[model samples]
Target chain A: MRHGRRRGRLTRVSSTKDKLLDATVETLRTHGIAGVSARTIAATAGVNQALVFYHFGSVDQLLAAACATATAQRVEVFHERFAEVGSLRELLAVGRELHTVERGTGHVAVLAQLLAGAQSDPRLGEATAAALDMWARELETVLDHVLRRTPLAGIADVAGLARAAAAAFIGIELYEGADPQGAGSALDALDQLGAILEAFDDLGPVASRALRAKVRQVTSK
Target chain B: MRHGRRRGRLTRVSSTKDKLLDATVETLRTHGIAGVSARTIAATAGVNQALVFYHFGSVDQLLAAACATATAQRVEVFHERFAEVGSLRELLAVGRELHTVERGTGHVAVLAQLLAGAQSDPRLGEATAAALDMWARELETVLDHVLRRTPLAGIADVAGLARAAAAAFIGIELYEGADPQGAGSALDALDQLGAILEAFDDLGPVASRALRAKVRQVTSK
Candidate 1:
């Protein structure tokens, strides 16, 4: 009888923890970082405020957990899509799709809040960076696969390109909030770059050789 | 004597306001957005907390004023240098110099906090975006001048490029906090892009025409 009751309690605890995480993300989406607190999160979760401290030790820890958990889930959902990206342009197309869905789901707002909160909290910054890295790592894999066939193969730093691409998307996401037209233009510019790369890839062997030599000569300088 | 005293009083009031503005920026630099308050700003300014409200009406107003005032001064300082940029490579070089200087002066940190704070605050968002526009405008002018001679002049969107460049830098600055090496790579990637543009400028007429046509074709598609 005691074992059965303990098992039931364990399930309840796990469910409450999940509820708290969801509530934290929701609060960040709706209230921004400033609106987040144990009271608010617990209220959103429909549980006692003490459970936050009990489960996560503090609100900051809960925030970090929530961000990491949510990002992991989101990244998992896109893993196959990211794997299917065959070209730089296709990668960008996926990015656009992801951006649209993330914006609609209010995850973009949640990201902004976490990034803002991270500035003031080191623990949160570490967690936020970790979450960001998950995306960067996925991008790096694709970049490695795609760039290997391009003139930029060895010359470009694939790792850096991955982070840069991730960062650019993050910046555009936030920038869109302030200047939608400018953001759209930035997106278009990226597409243009993608198209240019595709054109480079389409070059005949002799032209490709010449282009590679030129790219090498310029980058080396 | 009465007129002299009135002028002296006006000078003191202006000086106090300046002190508050400077303090607000300092507070943001050191404490992040979460640490900013009338109490903190006044403490940093060595004035009574009431002075913050008395001069700027509210903490948010003070932050907006400080961001605008500081950005204007920084942009003004760079006006001559920006005008001297004769090439995309030079512009990137200037961007590097500016990044280093801004990072050293803690303005980058302030920018991060403002961007974060802006996520939740519409008024702050307006002020931050306006400040960002100041940089974008400067970049747009330079892009117009440099790209005018390049194949990309009519093809690329200069206005969008300016905002994109500005956003990229902003993203890079923030991303640097999470991954310094990756940030360096991103900067190098930009430099590579600049070098490519420079190389395109060095192309012989026939090659340039061919490249331009190819670019147009790809972009049109």
Candidate 2:
């Protein structure tokens, strides 16, 4: 009987934790950083207010945990989506698709919250930066692979390209958040992608060769 | 006596209003959207708490006003910078300069706030969209002028290119925000800009001619 009671308590505790996380995301989406309060989050989770104190200890810790959860989820999603991209064109396509999915899911806004709060909250900023760095490294590896196979001379500044690509992705989120209907045309996104590709080609033989040499030198070093 | 009292009241009110706006921006930069409050902003501004309510009426209105002020300032700066850009390279140069200024001042973080907050606030969202549209229109005019002067055959997809360019600009902001050290090198921003310019050239002589023809046709019609 005692074992069963303990098992029941454990189940309740786990369920409460899940609720807290889910509530955190929902609150962030609807009310944003300013509106989220421990009381509000607990209310959204349908748990007692005291449960929040029990699970998170404090609101700052709760927010940090939420940011971590969101960051891990985003990194996992990027890894999965990029895995599907094989060619240069396919890579751009995947980038756009992933951009739409992430923005629409409110993940980007959550990220922005972490970013905006980061200056005041050092832990949140560090966590967000770490997540972005991981993604950039992954992208760099993929670009290196693509460069190795292409007829193009050098890797074409993978780090630079990745940073630009990431900016373009986030920029869409910026516009998408402001004007979903307007941004829906996808015209802007495609145009930028085309520009990135053209820029790659513009480097031509000399720039490409230099870039390739640089990539090799850096990777070796 | 009434007139003198009125003048004194008006001066006090205007000063209070200016102080409130300044506080809002500082609070946004330091604490972000979440930390903005009448009490908090008032405290930051070194004014009485009630002055926040007296000047702005509500937190939402205060934020909206702050957004409007910031957007106007940015547009003015961009227009002044790009007014002299006569070629594609010059245009890219302007882009680099604009981003450098934005990053150094952390104005981009303020932009991030509006971008993320727009998800929740329709008024702010519209304001942001309107700001972007203005940017697009200005860039389109510049491209249109260039197309007219050139022996180029196809129409310049100015609107399309502007949208793409804007996306790239935002991308630069995102990349720089996430990776300040990388941004300092500016490899990513420069590479992305090069890509956009190359693509602009590649829209082809045929497309350029068609675009010019279309422009003529539309203007005439």
Candidate 3:
């Protein structure tokens, strides 16, 4: 409890904890939630098995901590980049990159694992909810900007729009992971919307409408 | 080995198998994949524990069969009804209904449980992929008809549009289920789109564009 002297032990404790957490995440990524056990995690961390109980108390606690830590890290990776985007189109591109496992945050697979277990495990469910809430909060800001600049403004509830778009981004990732063709069609449609929105923004309202009539005539064929 | 002689036991055997499968689905709903076991399912089905393996060979095979059967039944519940919808508006409404746990298919929760395990288990992953494919195929047909009737038709790749829409529908459901706000925002935005599209369809292309511009002007203020 001595202020300066215990600081050394605290540092040692924190580092050991970090290593254990890292091993837990690695296990989740490679073996999944079911594969995570004190033995395997300690083996992966190269720590004495007793140290796991000393640090985290149980495998479940270690997993919950791993999920929080991994989710927080992923949020940091995307948050800085997404917050800087000036338009909806840029956000979608970043989202596309983040959703794919081979390309970006492999968090989706881990998230799916948590979500599945969350329905039955209250602690895991709360963790899953907190992670989703983090996403929804970030998206609301971007959608506010996109709506204010576009011809589609006032078209719906802004809050709802943000949530829906956020949901679609996640939905795309989950479906793609399962489907392999992924959301190729949905992303294509999104790209078209970005192009159209960019063009329509430059055209002004009256001209944009006039252009739509022409676009309809062409697309209708 | 004669085909006709064992038919009586065949009928009783198959009935017992069906009951075990039904118990598996119910257990998945109440407890989750991790909670499924011969003991739990046999108790739920009011049968002897050995009967589980005797009927399905193993707990894993029983769970897989349960997933497939439940998914097929849910798909049947929504499929023909969706195929008959007259417009995008109707499709969205139906999709919304099908996504929720209380109001629609409880498959979302079951699917979530499967997807979580799918990452670690090759067999579970394959089963999940097949189930999702069934959903996408049905949604594609509905979107094809909706796109054909709307001004948005031919604006982009119809296949992608269908897939993206299907993804969004799914994304909304999953997020809502996890978050507990119930997809209010996503659904609200969808309803707005439905309103806008319905209005646009009736107004003719030129007028609809004019109306959208006016909407922008109002929203911009």
* Candidate lDDT (C-alpha), each: 0.78, 0.63, 0.66
lDDT of 3 by residue, B1-221 (tens): 22222344544244677778778777777777667789999999888899998988988777777778777878887777887888877886786667654334356666655655566677776777787777777877787787686555545355666677766765665565567673676777666655445444654566546545543442233
TM-score of chain A of 2: 0.73
Question: Could you give the DockQ of candidate 3?
Answer: 0.33
The DockQ figures for the candidates are 0.44, 0.30, 0.33
Clashes of each: 0, 14, 3
Runs in model 3 deviating more than 4 A are: A1-14, A101-105, A152-156, A193-221, B1-14, B100-105, B193-221
Cα displacement (angstroms), candidate 2, residue B210, comes to 14
Best-first order by DockQ: 1, 3, 2
Q: How far does residue B1 in candidate 3 sit from its true spot (Å)? A: 31
- Sorting all predicted structures by lDDT, with the top scorer first, yields 1, 3, 2
Model 1's alpha-carbon lDDT is: 0.78
* Best-performing candidate as measured by DockQ: 1
Alpha-carbon deviation at B154 in model 1, angstroms: 1.2
Report the Cα lDDT for candidate 2: 0.63
Per residue, candidate 3 scores C-alpha lDDT tens digits across A119-159 of 67777767777877666677777777776766655443567
Residue A169, candidate 3: how far off, in angstroms? 3.7
